[model samples]
Target: MAALMIQGCGSDVGKSVLVAGLCRLFANQGLSVRPFKPQNMSNNAAVTVDGGEIGRAQALQAIACRTPASVDMNPVLLKPQSDVGAQLVVRGKMAGTWQARGYQERKAALLDVVLESFRALQAQSDLVIVEGAGSPAETNLRAGDIANMGFARAAQVPVVLVGDIDRGHVIAALVGAHAVLEPADRDMIAGFLINKFRGDPSLFDDGRAEIAARTGWADLGMAPWLAAARRLPAEDAVVLDRAGPGRARRVRIVAPMFPRIANFDDFDPLRAEPQVDFGFVPPGSPLPGDADLVILPGTKATLADLAFLRAQGWDIDLAAHVRRGGRVLGVCGGFQMLGRAISDPEGVEGPAGAAPGLGLLDVETVLTGDKVLRPTTGRLVSGAAFAGYEIHVGRTLGPDLQRPLLICDDGAGEGAVSADGRIAGAYVHGLFDRAEARAALLAQLGAASDGLDQHARVDAALDEIAAVLQQSFDIPRLAAIAGLEQRP
Candidate 1:
């Protein structure tokens, strides 16, 4: 099997999307392709067929390859709970939580684990497209780094550096990386990719040549700013701050942006709705007074974020929104925060303590060591069929559950509904993925549904992006670099 690693000049340089597009391109050629990331640090995750979780991006890549996602795809996942620490997941299971410095010290030991997963994928596929985490220029972390250069050299995988030209200074970013990387690390980069270029492709010929001349790395190709990217769910949280088009719409839906927000992908379908205007209200900002619906998004640490919500006076705004007859839906961790209280005696998330919740629903949650990871399908209480997944680490129970929001396929009730039916919550993420469910919920607000099929849209987008990559980059050269054509 042959493999090629895509490392970025920095995070958000379209590394994940590139790997995914490459996977699809090869798969179209009838090659058995697989994707692997040595390490990932994102709260936006996808439950795997193996009953574990990996970065949602990897799961998307697996879908592009037409394969079921496996834990071997992403062996090391760091889920941040706060600025200084994170809960570390290894091989699709929680290992433990560690501070930043502490993790740095411990990560060296994980190289073995990372390589094992990489070898596992390599054994099963004709081609394995590997993705690196963040930039390697942060060389101080280079000593024990398993995410970038360290993993690259260990696996003996040739690298193609990706630079985001849209961020400007494309010349410097590429040349600068060449300057900063150690000789050994620098040697691994066989070529460089210029991403998100706009306007005439010929305009950057000189620029690409300059980079190639200076760095002695081949110019793999320049990819234009792709429209298909918007259709995919972003793994980075920064996308939440993007300003809307200011277009008029029939309904406005807003969600408070929590510091530790998890699974923000849950909102992508709603954001795509034609009649809905959706946005994330940043911390310290008031929940839109005119909103038809306010969402409390899932977070990594429910108690901590719940406290932050109160500190931001969102508790008061939520009260006002409820008073204004606005509808509210809490999801997963957010659902826990909507209950009467949250208890974490084992400190599964943070300090062993209890805190009062927004009390929108008559329920309570207790943090536990066990995390639930399962894909579920059922019908909403509104009688609309829905399909989604569950990924969480708490158990909730109370009176509001008596008026359960939906019944599962096994006839067990899931989620809770308040007495007025204006407030609802569930541990299930992606509850709005199903068009019928989204339609049913929007209908309650007197809005019309556009009947969007998310799966089809995403698949079409993958096709579009793969086509773009095929035309933009020299596939034969890339394949030769990976020795893909040489051997097979």
Candidate 2:
């Protein structure tokens, strides 16, 4: 099987979206195109049909290609559990936790497994478009690198270098990549693509020519900023901007931005409501004074981020906010923080094994070495049955266990909630996507509420984007580039 790989000049230069676009572009031309990434690092993850987790970006690409996601689509994933340590996922399952130096030293051993996944994808699909992580030009980290050039060499796939024109230095970045690559790696590159061009692409004719002339590489074409891109799901750890279409409300939910924040998508549905406003405050900014609600999102490191929150005077402010009749909602690690105490005697998150919590809820949490992964269906405090998923490993207990906040069918029981309703916390993510649940919460806050079918809306948006790709992109050319053109 033959393929073309998309490698970026640097991180966040739109490699994921390009892979998604190409998948749709190729699939529209009567070809079966599958997306592949040897490795990915993100807190946003999705469970596959095989009941294993992979980064959400690959899942998005799979959706764009109109294919079901599987472990073979993404063989390796790294979820940052701490500043220096990552939870390594191989073949869609947990391999183990490893620190930076240790993982880098042993990375080469995983190349065989990655290549095996690529081989499986190649066998089934007419064209496989592989995506590279970060820049291939990072000479220092090239050793045992199975992500970019190494994966290309092993898979025998030609590469297309993509540079961000909006970032400036498009020519220098492209030229610099060719300069840094070893001769063998340089030969793997088929050409380059200038991505995210804001204005008319014709204006960059001279720049494109210069890049091609300087690097001796082909220029595929410049891609304009696709407005429909927002319709696509984001697969990065960064929180989505929460400032659109939502009306101002008295019951504001202020979420503090923890450094290694995970599962921030917990708040996405709320941002769509006309009667609710959710504000995400980064570390330096003060928590809103007059807000009716404050939320603590999940963190990879519970104890370390708890310390960071207190350092920024958020601890004292949180207490004051509760006194001022503000509601606080915490999810997962945040739920652990709202309890009386959190214990990590095994040093699961860091060297320190223990930390004092905000004590807003009567619960206590103990960190465990193992992670839990399952889809959960439960009843909310308002008695509305909800469906969501849980992917954490913190055991919690509280005095008010009799009144379950979330009654899971798996006997995982319920989360903690304050009796007075001033504070609440749950382990499940995406609970608010349920219209009845969101309306119940908003009703409690005295905000006007309306039900919007989020899942249906998102599906419609994805279909619209696929149609746009069908209309605008050079589908046949992309299919030919991906080696999907069959001889008559």
Best by TM-score: 1
Clashing pairs in 1: none
lDDT of 1 by residue, 42-153 (tens): 9999999899999999999998898999999999999999899899999999998899999998799999999999999999999999999999888888989999999999
Off by over 4 Å in 1: 486-488
Scanning candidate 2 in windows of ten residues, the lowest lDDT window is 238-247
True lDDT of residue 89, candidate 2: 87
TM-scores for all predictions: 0.98, 0.91
Whole-model lDDT, model 2: 0.80
Candidate 2 residue-wise lDDT, 98-187, digit = tens: 898999999999999999999999899888999999999998989999999999898788888999988889999999999989999999
Q: Tell me, what's the RMSD of every candidate?
A: 1.3, 2.8
Off by over 4 Å in 2: 27-33, 238-251, 383-385, 409-412, 448-450, 464-473, 486-488
Cα distance off (Å), candidate 2, residue 455: 3.4
TM-score of 1: 0.98
